[model samples]
Target: SGKVRAIVDDKGQQLKEAGPSMPVEVLGLGGVPSAGDNLTVVENEQRAREVAKYRQELATEKRTALAPTNFDTMFNTLSSNVIEFPVVVKADVQGSVEAIVNALHNLSNDDIKVRVLNGGVGAITESDVLLAGGSKAPIIGFNVRPNAKARELLKRDNVRMMYYDVIYHLTDAIAKEMIGELGPERIEHVVGRAQVKEVFKSGKRDKAAGLLVEEGVIRKGLFARLTRADVIVSATKIASLRRFKDDVDEVRAGLECGVVLEDTNDIKPGDQLEVFSVEERERTL
Candidate 1:
């Protein structure tokens, strides 16, 4: 709650009161008002305090409702494959905070996700530093500086601090960080395709398939998938390749060879085997 000390016209003349659409300056605000906030004159100071307390309670309830509380839910996050990068954000204005938070959220993908613990306008405070310290999350400030108490706590707790004035730089840096955490990307390339002509018993408990190389080339010890009616049955590797009881390393297109797949026994004639290899490449955002 704040008291109106004086209302002055644009020419520095004191005014008894001001009306809508009048050019005047209002003095004695308790806090810096955010853009689009309503300036309403309440009945009394006590009523203003009551409204402020109620709004504070509502904000607290919203925060508590968004937080994870159950043990199962907490443990699930710890055991998940997706990596989470938590951060606290502070900006010079509310609009800047919203833009930064939205940009960070948009960078999330299947491999990694960004979690903003808290976002607020104005300078970073001690409470924000404490929250970041508790969560082990870094603090990102956009066109805003931390207070002396917050700086002291950040140094004492060894928290990471990032300051940026440009929005794109902040987003690009975060994307690169996520890519680094996820490591390289794997790409699969199909090397060969072969159709099974016959299935016969190779040993007492093992079965082998006679494959006719339909395209490319099939090599022994390469990864392959067994497909029936265009549906994948199992993924197996070529254990052995033979032609007329003679061991062969590979068979080119338009050739017939017997192949024993490792750890797979569901072999059938007229099935298809797709041979492929994997390559690792640097990941990008």
Candidate 2:
């Protein structure tokens, strides 16, 4: 006779027969079998239950061993408002790191200030956390994450790690910690727009652009964005914004002016310029 399996119900009564070649649809009955029904092939269902119960008990005991131990709790003696906030900053890109570092540094004051222990561009690594641990600084990341080992170390050491997707939010949160009150939300408001009408060559090394202010007022020393068609070409600071042959502070909408972009001279006609400024309230958290 070929091998076969007897299907049993919760009452331990045979319901049907199944082929042994396919194995039983279920193994080791647990608790009370119900109407949905399960077919088990084990000859000793009681023994399987014993093993599962032992594993569950072991797991519970292990969990009980891992008690609370975070960095915040370990460093309860650290004083507040008496020292500068030492921070280690990391981001996905160099420009982002620079921007975030600058924003954080701008939040320092007489009462409490920001002191960046270190700054870098990359996924936060184990070494970074170790560095921060030595310096007793909190690690702040922008558009990045801690590596596997770093995460483990942070949990084990109770190191503070804060991550954010937006630079504005990241800066605001850190600012509030230093200022002791939640300040205003930072906003980027557009100031002016200009269309490049022509490119001018001044010297072998110097170059400038002739622009027509299309909207708002284009001011000197403001940040600018150069766009071609509908795509962004560059985002840089205005080295010099001039009108006529002399340097002027600003030009109103619909006026023609000259612009010198820092570190770039590939200005061309049909390029659009956008100027914006960062505005915010005066509070902190």
Candidate 2 clashing pairs, residues 3+ apart or interchain: 71-158, 176-285, 181-284, 181-285, 182-283, 182-284, 182-285, 183-283, 183-284
Q: Supply every candidate's count of residue pairs whose N, Cα or C atoms clash at under 3 angstroms.
A: 0, 9
Per-residue lDDT over 50-146 for candidate 2, one digit per residue giving the tens place of the 0 to 100 score: 6555654564345323233777744642534434677888888777877888888787765566777667677887867876787677899887899
TM-score of each: 0.68, 0.39
Q: What are the runs in model 2 whose C-alpha is more than 4 Å off?
A: 1-186, 280-285
TM-score for candidate 1:
0.68
Worst 10 residues of 2 by lDDT: 25-34
> Candidate 1, residues 121-209: lDDT per residue as tens digits?
87888878888888788899999999999999989999889999999999999888888888899898999999999999989988999
| Candidate with the greatest TM-score versus the true structure | 1
Which stretches of candidate 1 lie above 4 Å from their native place?
1-9, 12-24, 27-31, 40-87, 93-118, 126-137, 147-160, 181-183, 200-206
